[model samples]
Target: MGFLMDLIGTLLRVNNLTYRYSSQDRNLLEKVSFTIGLKEKIGIVGPNGSGKSTLIKILVGELTDFEGNIEKPKCDLKIGYLPQDVSRDSDRILLEEVKAALPEVYKVEKNLRVLEKRLENDVDTEVLRDYGELLSKYETIEGFQLEEKIKKALSKLGFTKDDMKRNYNKLSGGEKTRVELAKILLEEPDLLILDEPTNHLDINSLEWLEEYLRRYKGTILVTSHDRYFLNKVVTSILELRDGKSTIYSGNYSFYIYERNLKEKQAWEKYEEQNRKIKKMEREAKRRKIWAKRKEKEKIGAKDKGFITHRAAKLAKRAKAVETRIKQMIEEEKVNKPAVEKQIRVKLETARHSGKIVLDVCELSKSFGDRILFNSLNFTIIRGKTIGIIGPNGSGKTTLIRILLGEIPADSGFIRWRTNIKIGYHAQEQENLNMENTILTEVKRENSDETFVRIVLGCLKFSQKRVYEKIKNISIGERVKVSLAKVLASQPDVLILDEPTNHLDVHVREALENALADYSGTIIVASHDRYLIKKLADEILEINGKETKYFPGSYSELKSKVEL
Candidate 1:
C-alpha cells in the first residue's frame, strides 16, 4: 500500500465539510469528512437523495456554501470530472473533439521529435538540452503516443475508430457518453470524479469502463447504479447516509457485509443489556421485600435503638440499590431497526378475456416521415410480463402509448380482448395535479374516499401526507402517489413506464415482487436491469425499426441478442 501512504501524505482531503441548498430544509452534506488517496479508486454509493451528487458537486466547486476545508497538494494536480449527461457540439466530429483534450501535449511532442531528428549527430550541448526539455514536457503530458491511447480508450468503451469521425450531435446519448468518457481518459488527470458514468452504457461498454478504471493510474470517485461496476472498480466505498459519509474498507460487496455485521452486533448487544437489566431489577425487588420484613419486625424493638438504626440503614441501602437497579433497567439502549418499508401492491387483477390481449398486425408509426416502427408485428398474451428495453428515443414509449390507446398507429390494426381494461402509470402522470392535494388527486382518480386512504396507506403515505399539496411533495412521494392511483384502478392489464425513476432500491424490489405475484398481463418500459431481471418474463428489444422478442429475463435477452 505504498500508493495509499503517498496519497495520504500529499493528496486531496475534505475536512469537516457541510453544504446546504438554499431551498432545502437541511444540509445536503453535513459534517462529512473523507480523504481520497492518490491512485485509489473510490465508489460513492447511496440511495436516492442521499447527497451523492451533492458531494460530487462540492468536490468540483459547483456548489459553494458553509463548509470546512478542502486540502490538496501544493503541486499542480489536475482533476477531470464527468457529469451524468454530456452536451457536445453536434456539428464537430467526435474524434476531433476528443483530440482537442491535449493540444499542448501534442504540440510539445511534435517539437520534441523535430528537435531529436535535427540534432541527431550535432553533438551540441545546448541542442541536446533543448531537446531534453521538450521531451520532458511531452512525457509530463503522456504525449508519447497520444493517438494510440485515445484509440485504445475509445475502443475499450465499445466505440470503433470509425465512430470517432462521426458528428457528436448525430450520435445517440450512449455514444456521446462514450465519447466524453474517452476525452476524460485522454486528459490524464491526477483525479477523476464521475457521476452516473454508466447511465448511457450497455453491458459491454460498462464492463469495458470497469476494466479501464481498474488499470487507470489516477484516483477515481464514481457514482453509479451499476452494482457490478462498483464491485469491480472500487477498492473502497463511501456511502452517504443521513447527510453523513460512511467509509468502507473494501468494495461495494464488502460494504454490505460489514454493514450487516454491525447491525447484528448492535441488536445482540441491545438484547443482552435488556435481559441483564430485567434480572437485576427482579433481584432488587426481592431484596427490598426482605428488608421490608426486617423493618416490620424491628417496629416493636423500642429498647434496641442500635437494631432499629441498623435496620433503618439497611432499608436505606436497599432503597438506593433498588433505585440504581431501576435506573439501569430504564437506561438499556435499543438500536434502531436496520430495515426499510416499501410500497407493495398485491394487484388483484382479473384475467384477460382472450389468449391474445393485444395483437399488432403490420404496425407502423412515423413522425414527420421518420418511421419509428416499420411493419412491426407482435402479440402480447395473458399472464405475461413483457419488458420493452432500448436506448432513448427507440420508440419504446411510443409503442406503449399506442398499445394503451393514447395514440394511434400510423397504419396497423391493434386487436384487444373483448373487455380489456387498461391501467397505466404514465412517466409524467405525477405532474398532472401539482396544485391539488394528495387526497384530492387520489379522489379525482377514484371517488371512493376510504379506498383512496387505504391505497395511500399501502404506499406508505401518512395522514399528514394526504393533506399536503402535490407541489410540496418530493419526487419519490409523488411517484408513489401515481403508483397508488394505478393500484386503485385495478385494471385487467398494467402498463408502467420507467416506474423506477424516483424509487429507492428497496421500493423497486417490492414492486418487482408484487409484479411477479400478479396474475394478469403486464407491459413495462424500463432501463433498470435489476428490476427487469426480476419482473420481466419476456423482453422485447426495439432497435432502429427492428423489433426482437426474447422469451426470458433481461439476462436471457442479453444471451439471445449477443448470439
Candidate 2:
C-alpha cells in the first residue's frame, strides 16, 4: 500500500494478508497489504461482500486461522473496535458502564488508592517509586478526569443527564450504540477501529462524531458506506477489491476521482493493446500477400532466383512478425476492467393525484407529557421531493405514519386529494413477506411474471435469485425487493422512510437517480444527507418542540441551522 505514498509514523502494518471462509471456494481476502499510520484518519471502502467485515474481524484477532501478519509498532498497543452489531447485556447504569470501559484503568486507580494509603503509614523509597510510577500511568490513561471526560462525551453524543441514570438494558439499539461509542471515545484507545459506526447515529450525532474524530489524537481505521461521513472525517482511503487493497491519499471524493481515473487509464491501455495487436496482424497479413505476389511473378527469368529469394525473405519476416504477435498476446496483453455492478431500474409514477397532494393543518402529537411535535402545518405540492429529517425520537417516523394514515395525529387535518395513491417504502422493509420468494413478492406488484422478472432484473436480481426467499437474501437485496413492490404500485405520492439505510453506495446512487427522475411527489424521511441533498427541494425538519419547514435543499437547511 505504501508503494508511492509517504509512510511516516506508521502504527501497524498488514503484510500479505489472505483469508478464506471454510465453506468458500475462493479466498475472500487475498494478499491484502496496507500500512496504518499513527494518529491517521483512514477509511476502508468497498462494495458489499468485498470482505470488509472479514478484514476487520481478522485485524481485531477474531479469526486466527488466516494467513497474514499484523505488525503493531507498540508492544502494549490498545485498540477500540466498534463492529456493526453491538450487544451489551448489562443492568448497570450509563455512567457506570462507560466508567468501566477500560477495566485496566480501574486496576490502576485501585493501585493508586492502595499506594496513597501506604504513603499515609510508610514513606519508604520503594513505596514512593511505585506510587510515582502508578500515578504517571494513571495520568497517561486520563484516569484523573475520567468521569468528567465520560460525561462530556456522553452529552456530546446526545445522551441526556437523566439517560445516564437509566439502565443500559432499557436503552434502544441506537441508544445502546451511542452509549458504547461514548465509552470507546472516553476510553481513548491508541487505535480505534469503527465498522459502519454511522449506521445507528442520527444527523446531529453524526456531525458531532465527525468533529470528534477530526480532533481525536488516535489512529482510526473506519469502514462505512456513508460517503459524506468518510469525506468529512477521513484524510486517506484504503479501498479493498478482489481481496486486494488500493491506497488513496485523500478522502472519499478524492478516492472516487482517482478510482475513475485509474479505471479510465486501464481501459485506454487495454484498448491500445488490442489496437496494436490488430495492426500487427494486418501488417503480417499484408507482408504474406506481398511475398505470395512476388513468388507468383515470372517476370525477368534471370532475376527469377532473386525474386524467389526476396519472396523467401518477405515470408520469413512475416513469420517473425507473427511470432512476435503471438508472444505479445501471451505476455504483454492488458486485462480489461471488470464492469461495475449497479441497479438499472427506472421508477415511473402514475399521474393520477390532484394538484395539492397533501395538506396538513395544526398537526400536534404527544406521547404522555413529551410532545413530539406541535402545530405542524404544511402543504406538499405535486411532483416535489420533500425530505423529512429529525433526530431518532423526534417523531419523523410518527409524522410519516400520520401522513400515511397508519397513525392518528392528536389534533391535525390530513387532507389528501382524490386519486392519491400512496406507495410506501418502510425502512425495515416490513412490506415484504419473509416466507415468500422474491419473485412471489415482486409478482404481487404485477401479476404478469414476465413484467415482474424484468423489474427484478433491473433491480440486479438474477433469474435464480428471484426464486430465493426474502429472508435468505441480504438486507440490501431486500431493499431492492421493496423498491420493486413500490414501483409496481405506481402510486402518485411516494413515501420512503430511511430508504438509503443498509444500501451500498452503488445501489444508493441508483435509487437516488430513479427518485430524482420520478415525477410524483417524493416524501423521504431519512438520516442520509447525501440522498436528501440530491433529491429534496424542501425539507420538513421535525424537532420535538417544533416542526419547522425549510424551503430549500438540505445544504441550505444545514446553513440555516448552523446560523
Candidate 3:
C-alpha cells in the first residue's frame, strides 16, 4: 500500500505552462508540463537561453504571470531554491549564515533555555508545563544535533574550519555560492531546486555533492551542464529544448540513448506520412486528368449521358481526394524536431616543430607568503595533450601565464622550441578587446573579412550578433570570439585555461573534437572531467608546492592520485 501510494502521489504538477516576453512574438516556453513525485531526483538540461532558468523561476513562484496551472502540496511544505547567481550578502560568519536557514529551530532552542532559567528560580506549575512542552518540541525536531549537521554539511562542501570563521559577506563569488549551497542543504526543504550547482565546485566538492544528493531526503530538481555529475546524482532527466520539456526515465546516459531513438522514430514517422500524402496527391491528379479527357471525349457522342455521368463521378472523386488532402494537412502535420547548433573549430598547426615543444625547469611562484608552485619541472612533447588539474587556488592560471611569458616566475626558466608560435585562451577571456565588435576581433587575427565572417558564423554567431561589441555579448559568445582568434593564429602550441567553463555541452564536445584532431601540442587546465578524460594523453596534477605528471587519462590518474 505504501509503494502504491508513493507511485500515485504527485508532489508537483504543471499544466500547459506557457511563457513569453512582452517584446517577443513567440513564446519562450510553449505548453510545457511535467510532474515530480516525492523524493524524485530530476536533472534539467538545455542549451543556453532555452528557458531552463525560466521554468525554474516559475516552479519557485518567482514568475506568477505565466500561463499555467501548478498544483503543489497542500500540507505543510518548504522549498529551497539556489539560483545560478548567488548574491545574498550578510556580515555573519559562514556558520551563522548556514544556521540562519533554520531560524525556527534556533528560536525553539532559545525559548527552551529561557524557560529552563525561569523555572530554576520560580517553581510555578504553568512555567514548568511550558518548559516541558518546549523540551518535547525541541527533541522532536532533533534540534540538539543542528550544530553537528551544519558543520558536517560545510565540511563536505569543501569548507575548512578557517572558512567557517570568515565573514560570509567578504568571501569570493565561488565561496559565497558554496556557503549558499551549504545553507540550502542544511535547510532540508521538501523540494530543493538547484541551478548549475556544480559551476564553481572542484572535483572533490563535486564528488561530495553528488554523494550528498544521493542521500538527500527531498525532491531534487537541478539544472547543470555537468554531464558526469548529472549521471551520478539524478535518477531521471528532464530535457528542455525548443520551448518544450521531455522527461526521460533514466540517468544522463540513458537519456542520450533514448533521445536518439526517439528522434529517429519521429523522423521515420514524418517520412512515412509524407510518402502517403504524396501518393494521395498523385492519385488525385490522375483522377482529375481522366475526368477532363472523358468530358472532352463525351462531347456530341451518341452515349453522351453515360460518358458525362462517368466523367462527373471521376471529377467528384478528385474533389473528394483534394478535401482529404486538406484534412490530412490540417490534422496530421508532423513537426520535425529541432536540431541544436554546433560550433565548428579548426586549430591550425605548424608544419614541423622540434620533438620537445616546451620545458619548464625549477619553476617557482609565490603571492605574498603563500607559494603556489615550487621547483615545478615538466616537459611537453610535440603532438601531446596534457591536462592540468588542481583545487581552485592552485595556480593553474599563474602557471599558464608563466609559460606564455606574460608573468615572470620567481625562480626558473621556460624554454620553447624554435619557431613554435603559441596560442593562449585565458580563463577570464581577458585577451579579448571588449570595445571591439566580434567581427573586428576575429579580423585582427586574419585580415580577410569574408573568412572572418564565415568563421564567426561557424562558431554559431548570427550575422547580427557578429556586429555586437564583445562587452555586450554573453560570456559564452565572448569565449567563442576569443577562440576564433586563437584558431586563426595557427600556432604550433595551444594553451587553454579553463576553456570549457561557460560553454554548453554541444560546444564543449565540438572543442574536444577539434583538439583531438589537431596535430599540435595542446595543454589545458579544466575541471571538466569528461573533457579531460577524452582529450588528455597525460595528466599534470598540481598541488601546492608540487607538480606530478601521470602518463594516462584523467580516470587513470584519479586511481593513481588522491584528487
Candidate 4:
C-alpha cells in the first residue's frame, strides 16, 4: 500500500548467460540475457523445475559453471539472497546468529580501538599497518552503527528487541524466514533476489512484507505464487521457460492480458494459414489435372516438349506456395506459450440429509493444561455457508475435526442429521493416500466410471492428468483432486479446513465461484480474508470459551467489530 521505488537504471546486466548443471544433459539456462535495472522490481515466474531457482543461484554467485559475463555496477556490489526453506538450529540465540553477518567488521573495530589506546606505548609497525587497513575497510562499509541497523531491520520484520535474546531453534518456520529476511535487509544489498518470499507468511505478515518491499530502494528479483503480492510489488514480469527469459512490461495482470492477446492472435493466424494452405493445395491439384489434360492434347498434336516445361514450372510454383504457408504456421507457433491448465470435477452427494446438517452441544477441548476451547455450542443448517475465523491458535480447525469424528473432544456431544453424507477436506493429510492416482482416489469413493470422468472434468483434470500419481501433483492439484473425491461421494455437508492453501489466485477464484453456486451446506475454517468475504453467509467468530454468530458477510462483522 505504498509507492514502489522507481527504476533508476540498470544495476546488474547478465549477458549471454549459459549454464548447465553437472547432471543435466542440456543447458539449464541457454544463453539467457536480461538486465535488472536499479530500484526496479522484477518477478521471475514459471512452473517448477523451469530453472527459476537455478537462475537465481547463478545471479548470486552461488553456482559458477556459467558461460557469460555478469556486469555488476561495482566490484563489491553488495548482494543479498533469500532462499526458500528457512531452517534454523534452535540452539543459537537470534541476536548471535544475525550479528555473525558482521563479525569481521566488529572484530576490526575492537582491534582499532585497542591499537589506538596502546599508541602512546609505541605500537609495532605490523600492528599499525593492520589497524590502518581495518579502519579504512570499516569506514568503507559504514560500520559505525551496524548493530543498530540490524536491530531496526529485525524490528520492522516483526521481531521485538526482546525476541533478539530468544533461541533461533525455538522459532517456527515462519519466524525463521522473517529473521533471515531481516538479516538480508540489514546487509543493504544493492540487488536482492527473493524466491517465494511470501510462502509461509500470514495475511498480516504478508501485507507488512509487501509494504516493506515497496519502500525498499534496491533492485529486486522475486518469484512468488501470490498474485496480489506480484501485482502489488512487481514493476515487470520475467517469464522463464524453455531455457530463456522473456520480459513483459507492467504488472502481472498486464502480462496476463498481453499473453492472452498473443495467444488469440496466434490462434487466428494458425487458422488463417490452415485455410489458405488447404485452398492453395486444392487449386494446385485442379490446375495440375487441367494441365495434364492439356498436355495430353498437346502430345497428340506433336507439342510434348513445350507441355513438359510448362508442367514443371507449374509444379515448382505450387511447391513454393505450400512452403510459404507452412512457414507462416511455424512462425505463429514459435511465440505461443502454454496457458494455465484447469482441472474440472463434480461432487455428487449420493445421499441427502435432513435440514440440520450438524448439531453440537457443549463442546470442550484442551491440550494438556491449556484449554483451546470450553463450552462451545453451534449448529450448521443445510444450504448455508458458515465461516470460522479467529487467531492462529484458535480452535477453528479443532471444532471441524470434532464434528467429522476424526478427533475426539474431551467433552462434547456432536450429532449428525440422519442420512447425512459429509465431504471433509482435513488440514492434515488423513483423507489422502499419496500413492494413489488422481483418478484412482476419486474412483475409490465413487465406483461409476462416467461419474468419475465427469467429476474429474469439473475439477479441470484432463484425461492425461487423471493418470498422474497423487504424490507427483502440486498442492493445488492435490487439493482439487481431494475436492473431486468429496464431490464423488455427494455429501450433504462439506467441512473444509484452510482449503485455500497451495491454491493460485485463479484457482481460488474458481473455487470461490463453485462454492458460491453450491446448494449444499458448507462450513470452513480459514484465515483468507478474500475467501471469507466472498463466500461466507455467516461468520462464527471463535474465541476461547465462546463462539459468536453474526448474520451477513465478513464486511458486516468487521463493521460491527470496529464500531
Candidate 5:
C-alpha cells in the first residue's frame, strides 16, 4: 500500500468506466478512463452530448449503477459539486439559505419543530425540557454569529450587506451562481467539481473566480466552454470525444495546438486505412468470382472429382478470409478528427451598408430608480465588429434590445443608415418557437423544405435530428438552430447577445470564424473574451453607471485597464 501511494501518489483513478441512460439504445460513455492528480486543476471539455456531464455525474456518485471501478486516493475523500442551474427560491433570504445546509442547525431546528407540535396537542414537562435543550444546543453551535459567518463567506464573492436583505431570486444569473458556489465552498472538500461555471459569470467575476481557484489547495475538475477561462485557470485539459477520454498535459491554448497536429496525423492515418480497406474488399470480390467460375468449369470437366474438391477448398478459404475482413472493418474503423465536429456556416451579405452603420448620442436607460447606464455614446462602422462587454445586469442586453427596437431607451438619439435587413440572436433564445421542430423553426415563410434542410445540414443536424423538437434538443443544438436562421437571413447587419452561452468550443470556434469572415456590420454582447478578442475591432465596456469605449482588440483594452 505504501509503495502504491509512492508510485501514484494521491491520484483518483477511473478504470474502464461505462454508463448509459435507461432510455438510451447505446452507452453514453463506454470504457472511459482517466485519472486526477493531487491538487491538480483540470478542465473537462467537449462538444454537447459527448458525455462530459455524464462523466462528471458518475464521478460525483450522483449516478451509481455504472460498470467500473472508482479508486479514491483516500478512503474518506470528500467531493463538493456545483451543478448547472443551482438557482433556487429567489424569495429566500441569503443568510437563511446558507445556514440551511448545516446538519447541526437542521437537527436542532427539527427537534424544536417536533417539540412545538407536541406542545400544541398537550403541554408536558418532557416537551418543555426538550424544547429548552434544543435551544441551548443551537446557542452552543454559535447560532448568534451564524449570520456573520455566512455573511463573510458571501462577501468574498462580492455580496454586500444590502444584498443580504434583497431577494436571492432577483439577483442576476451570475450573482445566483456565486451564491450557490459559496455554499459548495463552505464544505471544504478535497475535490471541487464545477459544471458550466462560466455560463453566467461576467468578465470581472470570471477573473475573480479564476484567481481564487488558482490559489486553492484542493483538486479542481471544471467543465466550461469559455476558452480564455480554461486557458487562464487550468493546467491540464481532458477532452471527451466519441465516448473516450484524451488528456492533454497543458492549458487550452496548448491543447488546441497539439490537438490540431494530432488531428492532422489522425486524418492522414484514417485516409490511408480507408484505401487499404477498399483494396482488401476488391481482392475479396475477385476471389469470390474466381471460385464461382472454377465451379462452373468443373461441372463440364472430365476429372470432375478433383476439380470440385479444389474449388470447394478455395471457396472455403475465401469465405473465411471474407469473414475476417468484415470483422476488421467493423472493429478497427478509425474515428475521424474532432475538428470535423462543427457547424458549417458562411455568413454573407447581399448589399453593402454605408460607412456609418449606427450613430448614437446621449443614450440612457433606467429601470425604476436603478440606473443601468447613462449618457452612453458610441458609433459602429460598416463592415466592422463591435463587442459589447459588461457585468451582468449592466445594460449589455438592454443596449442590444434598444438598438434592435425590441425595447425602448429612456432617452437617446439613434440613427441607422443604409441597412435594411437585420439578423438578431437573443441570449435567452426567446426568438425561437419552443413548440416547433428544429426544421420548422429554420423554415421561413417562402423557403422550401430542401432549402431549409440544406441550411440545417450545414449546422450539423442530421436528417433525424432536424425532426426533433426544438425543446428536446440540447442547448448547443438549439444554438445551432438559432444560428442557422441568423446566417440564412444574409442580412446587412447582425446583432447577437450571449451567443456563446451554451456552445461547446468547436461550435464556438465555428461561429467565431463565420463572423470573422462576414463582410457586414456586427454588434455582439457577450462575456466570451476569446470570441471578443478574435472578432471585435472595437469594445464598448458598460459598468451600470457609465460606458467606456476602446477602439482596439480586447487584449489592448485589457492592457489599458487599471489595476
Candidate 6:
C-alpha cells in the first residue's frame, strides 16, 4: 500500500495547456497534458522550433502567461534549471563557482565557527546544544566532504586542477557550460532540468554524466539531441510533435521502436475507418434511392393509401440510416498521420584524384605553452570516411584549419594530391555569412536560382524560408543551408567539424544516408556517436599530445578500447 501510494504521487502535472506567442496566429502548444511522477527520469525530444525549449521554460515557471493548470509539488520543491545557454560573467574561479552552489553548507560551517569561539570563553548548555544540532545537520548533508565532491565533479567534466584555478569569466563558452553543469550536479535539487546538457561534453565526460545521472536520487527532466546520451540517461521519452506531447514508457531506442509501430497502427486504423465509412455511406445512398422510388410510386398509384404507407416506411428507414451515418462521421473521424521531412544532400565530386587524398606527417600544434597535439601522423585515402574523436581542445579543428591553409601549423607537413577540391564545414559555422539570405548563400556557389531553390527544397527548406536571412533561422536550418552550399560546390574532399551538432534525429539520419552514398573522401570530427558509428570506415582517436588511428568502425574501436 505504501509503494502504491508513492507511485501515485505526482511530481508535476500539466492539464489542458494552451500557449501561443502574441505575435503568432496559431497556438504553439494546444491542450497538451502530461504528468511526471516522483524520481522519474524523462527526456524531451523534438525538431527545432517544436516548442521543446518553450515547454521547458513553462515547466520551470519562467513563463506563466499560458492557459493551463500546472500542479506542482505541495511541499517545498527545489528546482534547478540549466538553460541551453549559460551566462559566463562570474568573476569567481571554477572551483569557487561550484562551491558557491552549496551556500547552506557554508552558512552552517560559519555558524559552527562562531559557536566554537563562544565555547572557548563561556561553556553555556544552550550554546553547546545549538552547536551540536548544527553540526549534526551539517554532517547529514555531507558538508565535510564538499571539497571532495567539487573536485570529483570537475575532474569528471574534463577540467584539470589547473582549470579549477582559472577565472570562470576567462573560460570559453563550452568551458563555462561545463563548469555550470558541474555546479548543477553539486546542487542536486529536488527537480533537475537540463536543456542540451551534452552540448559541450566529450565522449568521456558524456559517459561520466550518464553514470552520474543513473545514480541521481531526484527527478530529472532533460532535453537533448544526443541519441546515445538519451539512451543512456533517460528511463522514459516525451516526444513533442504538432503541438502535442506523447509519452513513451522506455528509452530512446524503445521510443523509436514503439513510434514506428504506433505510426503503422494509426495508418491502418485510418484506412479501416475510411473503408467502413465508405460502406455505410453507400448503404445510406441506396436506402435514400429506394425511398425516392417508393414516393414516386405513391404519387402515381391507383390505390394511393397503401402506396403512401409503404413510402412513409421507406422514408423513415432512410432517415434512420442518414442519422446513423451523421453520428459515425462526427464521432469516428480519422486524421491523416504526420509525415517528417527528409534532408537530401548530394556532394558532387570532381574527377578522380590520386589514391592518397591527404597525408600528414609529424604534425604538431600548440597555443603558447599548451600543446593540443604533437607528433600526429595520419593518412586519408580516396573514397574513405574518417571520424575524428577526442575531447575538446584536442586539435581536431586546428588540424582541419591547418589542412585548409587557414591557420599556420606550429610544425607539420600536410600534402594533398592534385585535383583535390576541398569543402570545409567549420564547427562554429564561420563560413556562412549571417546577413545573407539562404538563397543568396546558395547562389554564391551556383548562379542558377531555380536549381538552387530545388536544392534547398530537397534539404527541406520551403520556398518562403529560402528568402529569409540566415541569421533569423534556427541553428538546424542554418546547418542545412551550409550543407546545401557545400554540396553545390562539388568538392572532391569534404572536411566537416561537428556536422550533426544542431540537427534533430531524423535530419541527422537523412544526412547519414547522404554521406553513406557519397563517392568521395570524407573527414569528419563529431561528438555524435551514432553518426560516427554509422558513417565512419576508420577512426582517428586524438588524445592530448598523441593521435592514433584505429582500423574499423567506431563501435569496433570502442569495444576494443573497453576491453
On residues 1-563, what C-alpha lDDT tens digit does candidate 6 reach at each position? 01113544788898989899998888999898999888899999987777899999999888999998899865677888889888759898888788887888878977998999999999999999999999999999798899889999999999998888999899988888888898888888878899999988998899899999998888899999999989988999999888998999999999999999998898898899888878877877787788788878877679988877877777788788778877877987788788665555555686778889889898888899978878778888899999999987788888788889989888879999976788888766767899999999989988878767766876667878888999999888888889878766767988999998888876776677778867898999998998899889999988785678888999999899889
- Badly placed stretches (over 4 Å) of model 4 are 1-8, 22-27, 88-90, 95-165, 292-337, 340-343, 346-348, 351-391, 407-417, 434-438, 449-484, 500-522, 526-563
lDDT of each: 0.77, 0.85, 0.84, 0.76, 0.81, 0.85
Better of 2 and 4 by lDDT: 2
Q: Which residue pairs in candidate 1 collide?
A: 90-169
Clashes per prediction?
1, 0, 0, 19, 1, 0
- 79 Cα displacement, candidate 1 (Å): 1.2
Model 6 has a clash total of 0
lDDT of 1 at 183: 84
Q: Per-residue CA lDDT of candidate 4, range 1-563, in tens?
A: 11223443567788998988899999878888888887889998765567888888888878987998988653446677899777656576887678665667667767777988877588789878877888888888777677777777676666768999999988988788878887776666777889888766655556667888888887789988677778888999988777887889988889888877877887776677667768977876776776677566666667778877787777667677667767766774444335555544444455667778878788889999868777777777778899988755668887777887879999969888876777888765567789998888889888987888776776567788899999998877888888777767777788888887766555566677667656788898876767887789889887555668787788898888779
Best by TM-score: 2
Residue-by-residue lDDT tens digits, candidate 5, 355-412: 8888999999999998988887888888889999988778888888889888899997
What's the lDDT for candidate 1? 0.77
- Kindly report which residue stretches of model 2 are placed more than 4 angstroms away from their true locations once superposed: 1-8, 102-145, 289-314, 341-345, 447-464
Q: What tens digits encode model 3's per-residue C-alpha lDDT throughout 1-563?
A: 01113544778899999999888889999999899988899999887888988899999988888997999866655788999887778988888788778888878987887888888899999999888888889888888798888888888777778887999889988888888898888877888999899999887788889999999877899998888898899999988887888899989989989988998898898888889889999999999999999999988799999999999999999999989989988998887656645555555684569899888899999999989988888888999999998877788889888888889999989899987888898877877888999998888988878767756666667788888998898988788888878766677988988888888766676667767767899999988888888899999888675778787888887786565
lDDT of 1 by residue, 1-563 (tens): 11233535546888989988889998888899998877788998877778888888888888777579998777666788898777756587776667777778756766776877878867689888998888777777667577788788877776766787888789877678778888887776778889988766654566677788899877898987666678889999898888888899998779879977887887788788767768766776766676677667776777666766766776677777778766765675565555454445566774446788888788888889666878877888888889888755678899988987789998988888888888899877634589989898878767888877867766667678799988898887788878877767777888999887667544555566667767788899877777777778888887665777777788787787579
Alpha-carbon deviation at 318 in model 3, angstroms? 8.2
Clashes of 4: 19
TM-score against truth, every candidate = 0.75, 0.88, 0.85, 0.74, 0.78, 0.85
- Give the range where candidate 3 is weakest over 10 consecutive residues by summed lDDT: 1-10
Segments of candidate 5 deviating more than 4 angstroms:
1-8, 87-92, 99-158, 167-176, 273-343, 445-455
RMSD of each: 6.4, 5.1, 4.7, 6.9, 7.5, 5.1
Question: What value does the lDDT take at residue 121 in candidate 4?
Answer: 88
Worst 10 residues of 2 by lDDT: 1-10
